[model samples]
Target: MNVAINRKLILNILLFVVMIGVIIFVIRDSLSEIFTELGKTSWPVLLGVTMFGVISQVIEGYTIKNIANEFNREFSIRDGFFASAYATFYRVVTFGTGSIVSEVIYYHKKKLRYSEGTGTSALRMITYKIALMIWALFFLVVKNDAIQRYITNGTFLVIAGIFVTLLIVSVLLILSLNINAQVLLIIFCNRWFKHQKLRDIVDRINNQVYSLRAAIKAFIHDRNAVIRVFCSNMAKLVVWYFLPFFILVQEHPTIDIWLTVALISFTVILGGVLPAPGGIGGFEFVYVLLFRNVVGKVDAVSSLLLYRYATYLLPFLIGMIYVLFNKQRQINHEFKKAKKRS
Candidate 1:
């Protein structure tokens, strides 16, 4: 067991290193230009970007707090923020796979049951998806002409994204609310799969689905919490969508904020369709493709770099600091307890 644990730790470390290397390689060409643009950018604009970025993460923390409070009123905002930061760190390092695991473990450490933790994570994800679709649809309609004028295929992409998102939400709802569907799925899997391991995996998934169902039912009944979660997520999306505009607005004061928001909404929707981790490669591609005509190639590249820094790097760095500090505090507490025992 110890050997297995060690091996897993080593693998995770290697994966983290590899992810960092890939990120650096992807941005290698633009590093110089990004720095040049940074030098030219005003301090006030940079500060504004940083402020909004921090605000977005805090809102995410609050969203987590609100959700967890439904399950356990003892859950505090601090715990929520810790879980949020921890999840963000793992999400980036593990290419999005570790986010759910990270949050579950964090919540469990905070004394929530495993099922509660799982439910919290699952509900948070559902609400986030719903919020994304809502904002995407709203902006898509409000700024339809602007998006069409900028990108010839913008309408099609946004509509396709909305359709796919809706489909995913529908499936989750069916699984959560439809007991017959769940039973049939389990029965089908049990009959089709002969291997014990595959069967065990399916059983575990079924159990998780049950937990999610309970969470969905509870969350749906609490209309106030539902509204707050949606509003918080919408605010986060607004900050994210407008970040690039702020990044470039100093140089291009005439750039339309509404148009930028529309373009970003389209980019996010299309980017989410891709399987890339944290929407890294897919998001950059879509952003550049959509913004190049409006901002020109050089500015688009530079603005994207800054935009990425604000949206991705800042939150990640903050999360990393919080995680490391938490670990150190744990170690110190253990040492104090050991000393007292001695």
Candidate 2:
């Protein structure tokens, strides 16, 4: 057990180092100008942006807590926050694959079953997609003319994003609701793959699919919890989408707030299409490409840098800190328990 734990720790540390290197490489070109913009920005504005980012995470934690309670799991708000933070940390370092692993481990340690953990994480993702789709559609309609005027191939991108989002949601629903689909999927895999090992993998995934379907049914039946989680997700998006506006508004006080928010929503929708971790490179590309038409090149880059700092970097750092602190606390707890036994 200790050997396995140590190996996992080593792997996570390696991933963290690689993630930092990639981030630096991605932003190296803009570092100088980003620093200049940071210098000009007031401390108060930076603090406000940071606060909003913190609030967004707290809301995410609340959503997790509510969802767990709906499932009869004994999860506290603090546990939710820590779990969400570590999930974010792993999500970044592992190119979006490690979030679920981290959450399942965290939830298991918190006394919840692994299936419960997986189900909760899956539901959180589904809620986020639903919220993003709703907000994206609303803003697309409200600022349709402005977005089309500024963004190249804006209509196509919006349509593509909507289609992609809808496709994902629809597929998840089908898999969860249709046992026939699950059976057919397993049968197809079995028929084509001669490897017993591959067949075992499919069987494991099929079992998890059963758990997820139960979770989806529970989530749907609890209408009030659904509303609460959905609203919290929307609140999180609002804070995230408005962050760039806050970063730029000090200098460009004449910037239209709604237009900025709408562009951000569009950027987020399109960014999801990219497989990059946390949508790092693709998100920056889309943000700069679209915002430059409205805010000019330099401001676009500067605001994006600051916005990334506030939303991405800040939360990630906080999560890392919490992870370290939690580890230390666990060590102390074990030491005390051992001492008492001795």
Candidate 3:
């Protein structure tokens, strides 16, 4: 038991260290210019825009709360906030898996069943991804030019292709989360490929997927709650995109906010596929490269830093406080208990 705890501690420390290293590596070349832009930034506007970060947290937490209500579960709104915030911390610290793990942990600590935990987490991600797909369509209509400009950049083309492919796969996976093994086999695989071992494995997976799907339908049964959660997540998406909007707003008043948001969304989607923690290395790299084409190098780099800080770092700090100071021990305790029960 002590050995297991020690191993987790080591892993946590390693992931944190890697997080710092990636951030430093990302900002290495832009250090001077980023600082200069930070110095010149309008504090009042910047600070005001920062509030959107807090608003985003509220919406995310509320979305979780709504999901809980759908389950008739007894999770508190405060726990909802911590779940959303700390999950972001997990997402960053643990790369990306932490978000769902934290959500499940939140429920486990509340003594809720695993299905509720997982269902709530899955619902949050599904709604967010669907909203992003809608954002892509809007981008195509309003900011086609921004995308067109980057089409000639080889890096952009590669990243774009990856993003599209992942988006398609993600959509399919989410839509098919409820599908049975037989249905999946019929739609995706052939009879020739089937075997006893494979069928057994597929059946086990299908059982879990069916269970999860039942949970999903239960949530959707509360029609008003479903709509509220969906809209709340969409609002969160809007506010998050605004962080980048404020960065480019001052000198480029003529700039389309949608265009700015779309590019930011593009960076997020593209960065998400990268194999780095929370898309750290990949997000920063592609964001800087693409933004440099639109704005100058210095402004592009600086704005990227500001936007990231507001959207990522700020929430991450609050989340760490919630997890480290308030909830981490409890969640870890619950995880251990659950493991023992199994």
Task: Point out where model 2 deviates above 4 Å.
Answer: 1-41, 193-204, 274-280, 333-342
Say which prediction, candidate 2 or candidate 3, comes out ahead on lDDT: 2
Screening candidate 1 with a backbone cut-off below 3 angstroms (N, C-alpha, C), the clashing residue pairs are none
lDDT of each: 0.79, 0.79, 0.68
lDDT tens digits, residues 1-342, model 3? 656665665666565566566545534542444455556778875686568777887788788888877665676667777787777776766667557767677777776677767767766777777777667666666776786677455345544644675576475456445356437554564465477887676665554455467667887778998789878878888888877767777766776776678787677666655455553478887787677777778777778877766667667768767755543465466557556655
TM-score of each candidate? 0.83, 0.83, 0.71
Please write out the lDDT profile of model 2 over residues 1-342, one tens digit for every residue. 555555555565565566567546534543455556667778998788779878888888899988887655578878787778888776766667777888888888887778877888888888898888998899988988876897666878886898899898887778888999988888899899889999888887887778788878888898988889999999999999889888888889999999999999988888866445553587887888789998899889888878877676666667777776665565556555555555
Clashes of 2: 0
lDDT of 1 by residue, 1-342 (tens): 555555555555565567567546534543455556667778898788888788887888888888888788888867776687788777776667888888899998888778888888988888888888998889887988866776667688788888998898787789889999899999999899989999999988898889888877877798898888889888889888889888878889999998788888888788866445653588888788778989998888887878876777666667777766665565556555555555
